[model samples]
Target chain A: MTGRVIVITSGKGGVGKTTTSANIGTALAKNGASVVLIDTDIGLRNLDLLLGLENRIVYTLVDVVEERCKLKQALVKDKKNPNLCLLAAAQTRDKSAVDADQLKTICEQLQEDFDFVLVDCPAGIEEGFKTAISGASEAIVVTTPEMSAVRDADRIIGLLEAKEEIKSYRLLVNRVRPNLVQTNDMMSVDDVVEILSCDLIGIIPEDTGIITSTNRGEPIVNDENSPAGKAYINVAKRINGEEVPFLDINEPKGFDAFLAKVKTFFGIKG
Target chain B: MELNKRFIVDLSQAKTPADIVFEVSNILENPEAANRKIWLKLGDVSLNQSQILSIKSLISSINSTLSLIESECSQTELAAATLGINTKDVEEELQAELSTLEAESPKDTPSEQYIPLVDYKEEEPKESEHEQQENKEILDENKQQQEEIENKQDEQTTQNTEEQPAVSSDINQEENKKDEEIQNQLDSIFDSEVKLENILADDKDITEMQNWPLTKEAEDDFEIPEEIMTDEDYAILQMNTQYHKQTVRSGQVIQSNGNVVIIGDCHPGCEIHAAGDITVWGVLGGIAHAGCKGNTKAKIRALTLNAIQLRIADSYARRPDHIKNIYVEKSNTFTPEEARFVNGSIVILKVNDR
Candidate 1:
């Protein structure tokens, strides 16, 4: 039941890192495992907002490590779940606020009580990124199916693989539009997996719910009704050691489509 | 000198040595990972030193004996998510339902509760005295914003349920409106709790993690026989391990993906491979490969060239020569900066001409 610190990062920015952190943190919490999501973005912190826990923050990672507050004091409780917590980054500070060594020590402290420590890494492979990744036991490299993102993810993967800290790495392809992949217009999940060459963690479909949920500051996993939410829940369960089959978010032209053809008698879409 | 090694574990094909259940970075740092691969067995636990030393505290944490047990038990499931090195791990339907309950209770998470069993207290004090102070300086600025975000969300949920009596209907309405947000809290579980589930538990399964096997640390102690390479101890034994490529020329590839060696500059757009080391005698704009087989210690030496990029042991550093110098700076006109890793990043050092 010891905690694990995992950094969610992609070398390139805007691939939904904060969103992934919020959902994954929420997902793990949903699995009944205590989790703490650390926002390492520092100056550009946003994990608290994404998880909708902006107000509960009493102390932050900065305060805890600086001795301004205790480690437990910095942990912001998740509104939806008591097991989940958020260790917010310092908005006024920069990457220099923390180093890899400090983050590792803090994560070691957090690991005392939490089962999982998911670090929401800032964009770029600079000090901030290095600081964010320093403490994790492993890394979750988040990237989209796009080449640029994938390439940058590859660089990060290379960096992760380079250090003795990360023996191996895994990939999480965010914002995948299965439609484009099926049409051969974009890289398929296999293609992305083939390149990065690590364990494939999970595939999230291009769901508007992810964005709208982010804007609303609620984790998609909280919304049991959305497909993406279900996917995240599945991700959490997987994290917990359950072997769940992959859900094909591919455009379904199944029995429902056939039934719809029969309903064409009543007139649906042309 | 022996060079370093690095690898990306394909959990799908992840394999391990006979003696281990999980091969974390700490384990890699362990004396054993070099000569043998790392794997895990059911009901086995081996995690020590992965967290305290390297930046891979996460790996040490993820590859814990506890997570290994969870994966063996199949309590939680995995789902496909993320952009890199991640696999599709969907949970059993029952676990998915259980996952709902898990979402509600955060602090009491099973993983967090197990820390003491893993000997958490021992690792903290020694490190806290040394590492904690530095991190405090970094997170101070963003802390407030993060705290507010967390508080508001907690209040929001309270307000959501308190103001709206019908929870299910409101959830449904919210779900439909935010239909695109299939991204959920479960994703963090995959990164944190579930990643360990994918750790290769056996040797044969090592490839399941990735296609390549480059140890991040040099796997030494090969027990070199005294008879093999001691030509008077000059020891130039011809083992298949060392690859030697042809000479590099303009548009000249000593070997496609092979190591090309030259003493001068490489012509622009020329591809050269020198599995061992590339010694450029003259200035040439081109590509040079050094220690392609997961060896970061390999050196790339050159006089001068306009080559825009250089690949070394799975990393590429771009030359700022992309923009021609319009004029010399006021400091002093000098040659372009040499490539070096300064402050942990690869950058060109604009050295003054001698």
Candidate 2:
């Protein structure tokens, strides 16, 4: 079956592009869809690490392109899910090792076997980004609530719109601190969606669990208790053409809710 | 003439050179230290000749002559020696003085008073002496073992040379047979770079190769053959060794035609490629390719072998996924390991095992 090729891109660095790609790909796989994640960020690939498939990667995309190994031989199967696979990037090589046309060919070949092919794009609108987006028909622009990240996301969206291959693009606002947004210190998800004038697929609340999950080499999506994990799962569902409602992260929880209630009892505005 | 009273100022506990000076100055502030000969005891803090002279002058300011200095550091001792001060080991001097006191004491005097002082003084030195003896024995054993190994290797080489002519015609046939067996085994192991042309010629279906699971069972696919040094090992030893004395950070690639010896830590993401062996004196946390030119007998060794990937000849092994720590914790203790091509797979062995 032909697969839907989606490129996860962010013009800014450290905007959770790799993390989103890993979690979304994993979440889709957990839903029983055969998925393959391609990491095009040569020399600094972290998608494999995030998926906990770094050691399992015996052959990379470069190896497949250079004919050192077959295309199927380069696909590293996921540890937990047999339906998921990863085409890792060469750590020693730079973006010069791969070009846009070569990646498109690889993606075309992968489309026949998998239900979805997710490309984790590297930061910057350089050769690496061009090569990453070259293979995908859809795009997901990942960004934090910060102005700098939002601006970069807008630029990435513009670039995606300019490309005829990218039929549609969705905005995923990540690391959204709800308390700060309530205090008007940070932008709300609506403000980001309004500023970019784009469709919103998900809003992931800032979770400290992401750091631990990254260090542990496990995707945050596997953590059912985490709010970010739940948000990511919802995003995956939305991607799979399911009607999943957005999470109400704005509501105060646990200790914060207790403090808010105390403030309300005293007739004080919180 | 009356003999001068000796006052010992022990500042051995002072951690830094500045701390030692501060403590010595604080002790000299006391009025009781005046008119006495000062004996300073210092720890492992290295003091230069000028610093020793300054300390001497500070002692002299209290009208006490700096007669002796005892130090644990050899550099400190050398400095004290240069200043014409008697540098002695505290225990040795105490032992000598105790011996003198015993000789001078009358036979009728009670020996009970001397017992405690003798016991305290002897305990530390006795244990240290025992440790020194044990260290010497271990060194001797290591040397003997090394000599024996060298002799055995020499015997093997001589035997190989003598048998070369008789079996020279059969060597090519045997090598072809071994190559066929290795080709069969390559599919089970992840040797992507091995015999690429042959694999392509065979036109094996890509889907036919089973994806090896990342488990203990996959590790068992690697056969750790018995440790036997081949001619390739000797050839690697004969290669020139390049010494590098800097931290190899990420993105930096160190390539050498012969052996490579890095004196610092190889951080994650760096690449080290050597035609012979690759040796890192510190932590090897990056990718190390030993025998990059296809010498199967080459080795990769480090004080801490936490390399992300170890490649020797055509066989490569990545760090197991179970090890979640992408970056190895920087620790003082290290289990030195060496990786080499054994049979058809890469095997890691503790360096001390040899």
Candidate 3:
């Protein structure tokens, strides 16, 4: 079966779209499906830095679109996974260098080799945003549960749904802190999902590992030790058609899961 | 197992070209994601042989359905028009070609005289004289109860769109009915160049935005003197200003939870501080201060724009919109309109109830 091209985008910046792309693309690749992470955030490119493959990018997405370099040539292989490739964005040029039509063609070509093409969209609803989602088979709209992010996410989700492929779109809630939500200071996943009104693919909790990992140019999902990383792995598994249980962050250490683990060990049916 | 070649019409296009949309359409048909894989692609160009064929039929069906939908759309459009959309105009358009048919058939006149359309009023303002004409017209025109109810509902829905959105569930049922397919025979007209007409106006700016013919730089930040003038007296004076200082830190967006007032004619150079709601009566020709301090619920309303910069709080939309075409007809910006945050983008609707 051919892979689906998923564009991860958020209307407001710093809402973990690039993070989701790197993590999901890498996670999907780690599961043995060949994945390509196409960073469409031109001028303000960060996916490469997040992926920790910034130095290997001899050519960027603009190069591929402009035909300065072949699609395969511009693809920088991640150090850990040969299955995953990072098609970096052009830092020198702006978003207009690649239009939506060109992106569609690029995705079409990339679709032939890969099982999944995950596009990391630029922040705003500009040319970069349009080009990023041009050929995506579906989209995973990333948003925080915060009011401002949710409002922007609401708009983006509305725009995405107006597209014919609305059914293929799912949401990814990132940088969510369960404690803040519990305290009512932050909007909960339920509130965001309700407003956005889309099927949710993943929920990433606010973790310090994300910050440290970001600084190291490595996405938090690559770290198996982190709780957020496990969640991303589970999401990747779900995307790949595997039946995986969600890790309830609020109740991960609670009695319900504690009892469920006991039940699994005893070979009892759940 | 035999392969089924059922014709799948792509009713999904004519909107956005998003991936989740294509994937979801394919996924809906086969949620199992097993068996033969089908590609649901988007393009004005024919994607494949069957898809090309499918798109043609889809377009025709959509057009035909749109005709039916336009009746509902027109009914809503009429309902929306506060000035009232001329329904008889549409009816006359359909009958224009039928005049030859009527000329051929002499019996058409006598039968038409007996059938009184309950909803149809043979008056200039059909909506105004509803009581006596409606009760008698329904008895004369429609015999079916269900059709009468639906028509009555249509009459109540004199609007382009209904808010409170409770009617979304019922909208589909109304769209199925066949309507008189009459093209707009009347010359479509647009009323533009809003008549400010010596209304009480306040204006001033930091620096005017792009290619505006006039630029005014006023150093004085004028004050809105709290003299409670009568609405009529207030309407007479044309007030204006430059900047109403509110401390906005770097990277901090401006926001207002309520209707915000940008007290001056904003220069293209001025950075506004606003969130929630913003209302600038004067020309907004500069940078919009939005989401200032990270409040995203803000929106800006201005009389005119030839601005250089725009920011929705900390999120800056620099020199945001370039009005490419001001077509007289066939555009949302067909009249003097107001822009509000709708969907993801700003939609220009009639300034007041129209």
What TM-score would chain A of each candidate receive against the reference chain A?
0.91, 0.94, 0.90
For candidate 2, write residues A144-189 as lDDT tens digits. 9889999999888888989999999999999999889998999999
Best by lDDT: 2
Clash pairs, candidate 2, are none
Question: What lDDT is reached at residue B145 by model 1?
Answer: 35
- Tens digits of per-residue lDDT, candidate 3, B1-354, equal 111111112222222112212222333333221221122222232121122222222222222111111122232233213212222333343355246555765444321111111332222222211222433453454346436444533432332211111111211323222111110100011111221111011221211111122112211211111122354223222222233444322222333433456554544223455434455656654446443444433445665543333444333232211221111122233123343332232222235333
Q: Which scores better on DockQ, 1 or 2? A: 2
| TM-scores for all predictions | 0.42, 0.63, 0.41
Model 1: lDDT to the true structure: 0.52
What is the iRMSD in Å for candidate 2?
2.7
| Candidate 3 accuracy as lDDT | 0.53
Segments of candidate 2 deviating more than 4 angstroms: A253-256, A259-270, B1-210, B215-228
Query: lDDT tens string, model 2, B160-181?
Result: 1110111112123343344344
lDDT of 2 at B288: 91
- Model 3 residue B24 lDDT score: 29
